[model samples]
Target: MALAQYARLGVISRSAPGLVLARPLLAAVPRSTTTSVLRSLASSARAGRFASSRREPGMVPVGRRTRELPVNTIIKFVPQQEAWVVERMGKFDRILEPGLAFLVPVLDQVKYVQSLKEVAIEIPTQSAITQDNVTLELDGVLYYRVVDPYKASYGVENAEFSVAQLAQTTMRAEIGQMTLDRTLAERNQLNINIVESINTAAHDWGIRCLRYEIRDIHPPENVVQAMHSQVSAERSKRAQILESEGARQAAINVAEGHKQATILASEAVKTERINEALGAAEAILAHARATAQGIEKVAASISDSPNGHDAVSLTVAEKYVDAFGNLAKQGTTVIVPTDVNNVGSMVAQALAVYKNIGQARETPTALPKDSRKQAILDTLVPQQDTPPARK
Candidate 1:
């Protein structure tokens, strides 16, 4: 019933045989008035098996007939070429050249002609095996251009889909031949190899695979985690080594500083000792020089005196008394000359000794005051007496 309505409305072309019902009454129709009559016949044919294929612009379909029909005659049937152009009018009509065209009407229709420019294909997610037999998920994008319109439209059912399959196959093959390390290190080479291989296989389909890119690589979760841990461990090891080296250097510096300080301290001690020894030697020399000067002064005074005999007696007696006093103070026992045994004798002996010493200097002794020695010495000194007897 729908087909009958489409036929009445002239929606489908009736050019192909067995597509619509044939009417003998419309055979004798003239071309100028035949459309209205065909429309009436289509209204009657709607309830029958005469279905309309499609309606075309500037062209009409003729009903299926047992007899051969001439071209260019008006009928309910559409020509194969006109129907072909009409079916695809919505897709390529703007680019298609306007002229006579043909199709099989319901049996054949025109498909859209895609542009020949570069088209991007979003690669589907895929898995590939590495040389180590590790599976990886990868994704990418593809760039392609159509080289031939006819071949691209007819040669393959889907040129983009065919290129994608080729890309996936080539990528898998390349990846399987290489280890994971090589695959990651030589990604540019991998991309070029896949592109070339895909381009070679896609020539028949009128597609030129210009470039293939492997964008992101997804390794196994365990492998990624292992790599992360390895990196962390390496960093930690380096840090510890550096810290140890720094500590070792610090210790070395401290030891060296202590050694230097000890050497300096020892040098200071040696310098102080030398200075002290020099000072002590100087002090001893100064004391010896002062003592010698004192001795020279005393000797000169004694020599210049006129009564040198008396001066010698007094100085000798004072020295003797001082020695005795020192000895008595330092010792438990003291010895002195016995006055009862030798006082007169010792005094006379001292006077005689003094006389002799004075004669050597041609001087005389001064008698002690309030002593008998003054009168005695005055009486005995200048008398020219008889010759001294030898005794």
Candidate 2:
């Protein structure tokens, strides 16, 4: 198996005498992989050079080395999500992708392997003065990714520490620009502004600012009290406004109801008045019709009666007796007939006038009864003055 393996990997000699090399190894691997391999081997060869680099990563063993160094170097294996920065004589050379790479020994160096994954870093709590001159203690977290390995390794001493400090200073500056209320109220805007500010400066450092989040913001006791009071007052004002609106709506409803009731009541009154007027008008029309009918009946009877004269004379005498009787009963001073004998003459004149009216219409009726005439005569007769027999 050893012979077959040796045959498969044919070995050759370099330009130097007695120096055997496996140039086939570098030929079989890619330039990047071969370069990385050579750089790591060179880093390990420089006795004290790689000693301090022990803290750095990417020291994995790939192949066995002979007692004599080879002209071509073995390739290094790079894992996923990792990068290796190569420096030629301590100067920036190239970034090694995840693969097998070889380099010139003693000339190239594998500085370190950098992680391209995102990391979350916590920013310590810091005291800052707002634009309103209010002092507040605040803390947050930051997420970042390393985009460029070369700049990350050589641009800054400590990327994590430098990023943290930059975030702190930028946060303070941003907080200083705004008032305390804006900072506390607009957290999203604050985070966006902080991310923007940090990203602007972090591009040179090969660090990408992903996102930032505010964790805690502690205000002074006095400020907290004032905020609480302001909130309470706002709540109270809203409640009062809502209550007033409710009351106003109720009042409008009540007033509308009253107006409707008044309209209905007035309508009823108007209807009643119209009904009463209609009833009165009907009564007056009936009364006028009744009066006309009564007058017509009396006139017809007078024209049909042949003895209408005697009946009229009897009616006049009876009416005169009734009047004299009522006057004698009610008044202390009585109105005597001008002459007691004149009553008979007045009734006789009434009889003659009615007789002439009946003859003209050609109607004859029976005379009144003899008793009624005798009673009328007796009522009209006055007793002669009686002499007083004794004082």
Candidate 3:
């Protein structure tokens, strides 16, 4: 009986152990390939975790290795300058092709924008006195360009602002030392000199001085007014001088005309006087010739009167009578040539000559009664003897 109970208890124990063993075998039989696949999956998951832990943020993962990637690895390079920012999210989306990319960290980021293309500066207008003690104003412009990008970026805190300030200070110092007159007189040359001076120093600051211009200058109002007045006065003086000179020339012309007229009048008078004198002389010569001719003819005809007393008396009486007759015809006043005392003597002489001629012509008369005595006396007398009878 003891042995049977023991066998029975042993069988129960065996049955429980067999149940445990059968349940495990049944589960193992259904999941054999699945278990192998699960094992491979777990191993793959472990490897992926390991890869993820080893990768850098901006690195491109390439199977167990990481590469410092270019900006174009996942996005197009939108060209960023140093110290500038760029948003490339959409660009990266277009470039990435189910792949990986790397990029420089933010601390090493490059800039992407440029600076201003041009810069201008104005120098302060300066007041100065010229060598002539004249006050003047000087104003100028400064032009500059960035030569070194790196120096422009790092040399000055603000390149434009710093260069402008430097230029102002430098120009002020230079202009103040110059006289106002010099600044005004040599504006262009001063600009070039200033530009050269500024450029010489600006080269170290990565600035290049380009062309410079002088804008405007203002002088004292009085100086300008004085210059204008001086010009006007000069013009007025010149006009006055010209007018005076013209008047003088006119006076000279008048004098010359008067002189010519006087000379012509004097010459005319001289010619007239000479002609009158010549005419008088010719008349005197012709009258003398006629008188001589009359004298010669009278002398030739008086042959019987050689002593010439009767001829002279006759000629004188004839001339006197002709003069009286001519004076009566022309009604001219006359001064007779014969004296009253000589007139009777001249007439008696003429009568005596006539009687002598008559007596000579008479013949001895025949007796005439007159008685016969009177006839004889009458015959003895000349035929021209009328005066003896009257006595």
Q: On residues 185-210, what C-alpha lDDT tens digit does candidate 1 reach at each position?
A: 99999999999889788888877988
How do the residues 245-349 of candidate 2 rate in per-residue lDDT, one tens digit apiece? 999999999999999999999999999999999999999999999999998987788789998766766778887667557646854223244665666775654
Q: Which tens-of-lDDT digit does each residue in 152-265 have in candidate 3?
A: 544655555666666666655656667764675677777777678777776766667886777877779998888689889999999999999999999999999999999999
Check candidate 3 and list the clashing pairs.
58-102, 80-111, 81-111, 81-112, 82-111, 83-111, 84-111, 129-180, 130-181, 369-372
Q: Which stretches of candidate 3 lie over 4 Å from their true place?
A: 1-103, 107-116, 133-135, 154-158, 169-182, 221-391
Which ranking of candidates, highest lDDT first? 2, 1, 3
Q: Pick the candidate with the highest lDDT.
A: 2
Stretch of 10 with least lDDT, candidate 1: 61-70
